[model samples]
Target: MDISDCKLLKVTMDFSKLNEWRTLPCPKCEIQLDIVLACGQSFRWTQLHPGIWCGVFAKKLWLLKQNEDEVMYQVFGGKTTDSTAELIDYLQLDVNLNDLYKKWAKDDSIFSKMVDNKFHGIRVLRQDPVENLFSFICSSNNNIERISSMVEELCVHYGEQIETFGEKTFYAFPTVKALASVGVEAKLRELKFGYRAGYISRTAEYINSQEEGEKWLYNLRMEPYDIAREKLQKLTGVGAKVADCVCLMSLDKPGAIPVDTHVQQIACRDYLPSLKDKKSLTPKCYDEIATHFRNLWGEYAGWAQAVLFAAELQRPKVKNLVCLPQGRKSTKMEEIAKVSEPKTKIKRKKIK
Candidate 1:
């Protein structure tokens, strides 16, 4: 209930896309990440029958349509706190918005010029660096649903608690010490985390035990983001895409472009011979393609990729479009997907 350290602002922005944007279901489980995280506002966890400290005022980059202006609302931790203001003033989410508009204008890059001269919106919102690293590690070959599940499992079993969001409780993201406290291999598998368990535990151990963990990552920042990616490639279970995801989302490395399976497919479909064959197109071929994309989009490469990734993940399902009255729905209706999906039923909806 204490937010004395939080800042406040009243910038002109739109959130008309709040509901539509929140609809992006978790790719792995097909539930909504927003709903799982409680619309990015309530990251709660209940312990010992009482709600204790375990919530983070998180922010998400949203495509908000305000009147004629289609812009991003940095919704979450804001300049001020009844928890209402946009994150623009806080995270200082930045990139050349004008340049991004051009690139995202069409199937073409957001940088392309529009005939009407009205710019399409574009920008990047920074996230907590440490969380971003661990999150992407859960993301390898796995769907967003499974990734979110593993992350929640990681926290519930290890993270500390936050208390601001009432008895609505949540575990803190596990720290190096916290993560090292238990055997991740068994816990992760028991939670159905798939193969990522090994990577998660090994990475956590290295991060905690090494005297030079931060220094190692910090020094990578000095190199070009691609080179830094090469360094991370040496870690366990970190493939080209996973390393790039960490680079772009966590490190704020603009040149880092994560070529997820979706991106790989898009690349092959949109451009010529995008896929790398064994002899001619190796992993290096993929890197070169990512580099081409990074160079083409310039600085907002990471941000641009996020918007695209979100769009791709949202399979445009219209199977059940339940429009609730604008007034708040009771909290009980939310999908606690991350924590309970392993035991949850699978519901499929059609995209009308």
Candidate 2:
């Protein structure tokens, strides 16, 4: 089915009615609502009830619910004049995910197994660039729970309050200027942001200094993926992984793969078996792994990577693994040690 042909019409007679709901036919094969929302690509969404989620985007709060055949959405605080266009772009309904999956699965046996019936309906989101940037800055060396918490706090502290539902209040993601005015670093520290506090503040300040600000980030979409990633890395706390994430999720660079430790483990285990014996993933190995996926999956390589990453995340954690050498400790062990280490002093790196 061509998503361009998909149209969204109001279910009720009065299109301007307050709290009016609209249903858009979203086939399960094309877009899986649950996997798309909860798959770690985004952080602001909250599952308010079973099969229903509430999220804020573009300074508007929306409620989305999905069934086997369709997705129902309603805007609470603000009216969208072009609701259909917004929904289509936001969900990327125009791209046929099933076709991409079939094409990607042809060259890769490992990817074929990964993209089984269980992984269907997973699609990469096209998020706002500024929100994507700051959210990812909070993601360095962080888990999803903490990342979500930090982002929520940032919104609550600096963003405009959009609406209140039950005990939950929704706020828009803060503008760069608004965040910079709050002395973001100190405020974030007070909110328990740890080392990431400074990175968010400095990155925001840098963006604000530019005449285009948010537009500067948005315009990267027109550049080559490598060039865009290079420019993004100039921001504080943005490494290759974060830049690639921004490229893949927000900048329409579907070939950009963000290889963190989890993705590296998958590469070592499934794709590059020779790397299993290596102690750590060097820069070269990382690039090679990313390149291998790009070669295998073509333009939508990052989407395939996301599916594999989500599979790894959902897999049951085994406390005692049988595969590793008896004397060797896993990278996860090293991470635990680093986290448990006592903090004797606070050291801050000077941002150029």
Candidate 3:
């Protein structure tokens, strides 16, 4: 899979009923493809154009574009199945995000203040458990760009080829057996996976050795959140954060909150000031912070955390200004902050 071979299609396709593209009536506020796809929840999506995204998920290559009212999509590969149903499930369209936002805002004042229209559509993607597990494994000590590249390499090396759109060929996410094959660790190391190569390879081997195999991983969705997180931690390279990510993103546990260093800062600065000086997140500290958030935001604490986390990520970098002595002027930091601010300024609607 040569990166140079993939080219973005310049021309937009017509959305006629006669064509393969079909529309799902979802407002931009409800399902903003730009925010949700680009957010750290999933890494498979690539922006083909400004508003158009092409990704491989659910064993199919998807071409999607959104407008103010609806999302138009077409499937290029995989069996002829009910793509509409698949899209609805993948996007978790049944989850009523407006109501959830309102609920979170009502409960947490900080969340209410942070609720900007620009980050409204940030929701978790219901990804495959196996893909979600492995992806997050690659996420440890890695940025989104690097994790995405690693995932692409994984798909290209082991996953089944689906189809080629434009100059790029698509491949489904690899199965546990495919990842478990001998020499996967060495090959991944050769691909510059670093220490995570062993984690992925060993985890895949462990999963493949199970009697139920991939089904065992998906079945954790039925278990309690605590149990599921515990079970996931048993696998190689899966810590509390990674396990919680799998639970929240794929295993139907909305209460699971992943607390990393960035999340620690968010918690200490805004919500938990008493623990602001804490340097490292111990198991006890992690549980305490997660519990506090769960109490503040209720059942869907994970979702609320995601919204705030994205807000923090998009927040202007002005810490130098904050740290400046009283009445002192820092022109350089101010200019950087102004430039980093989001261009879109749609006022947030009051949640009553």
RMSD of each: 13.5, 16.0, 11.3
Lowest-scoring 10 consecutive residues by lDDT in candidate 3?
1-10
**Which structure is stronger by lDDT: 2 or 3?**
3
Question: What is the total number of backbone clashes in candidate 1?
Answer: 27
lDDT of the candidates, in the order given:
0.45, 0.73, 0.78
Looking at model 2, residue 165 earns an lDDT score of 61
Candidate 3, residue 70: lDDT: 72
Q: Give the alpha carbon lDDT tens digit for every residue of 194-300 in model 1.
A: 78778777777776666775456555656787688877877677777767766765565766776655566555555436363423435876776687676665565
The lDDT-based order of candidates, best leading, equals 3, 2, 1
- In candidate 2, stretches whose alpha carbon ends up further than 4 angstroms from where it belongs are 1-20, 315-352
The best candidate by TM-score is 3
Q: Estimate each model's TM-score.
A: 0.60, 0.82, 0.84
Q: Model 3, which residues run further than 4 Å from truth?
A: 1-20, 315-352
| Candidate 1, poorest ten consecutive residues by summed lDDT | 45-54
Candidate with more favorable, higher lDDT: 1 or 3: 3
Instruction: Write the residue-wise lDDT of candidate 3 on 1-352 in tens digits.
Output: 0111122223222223113456777777777787677777887876654555778888998877777877778678899997877888888777778888888888878898987898787777889999999999998887766787889899999999997664457789999999999999999999999999999999999988999998999999999998999999999999999999999999999889999877888889998898987778989889989999999988878988988887877832211101233453444322222112122212223332
Sort by TM-score, top down from the best: 3, 2, 1
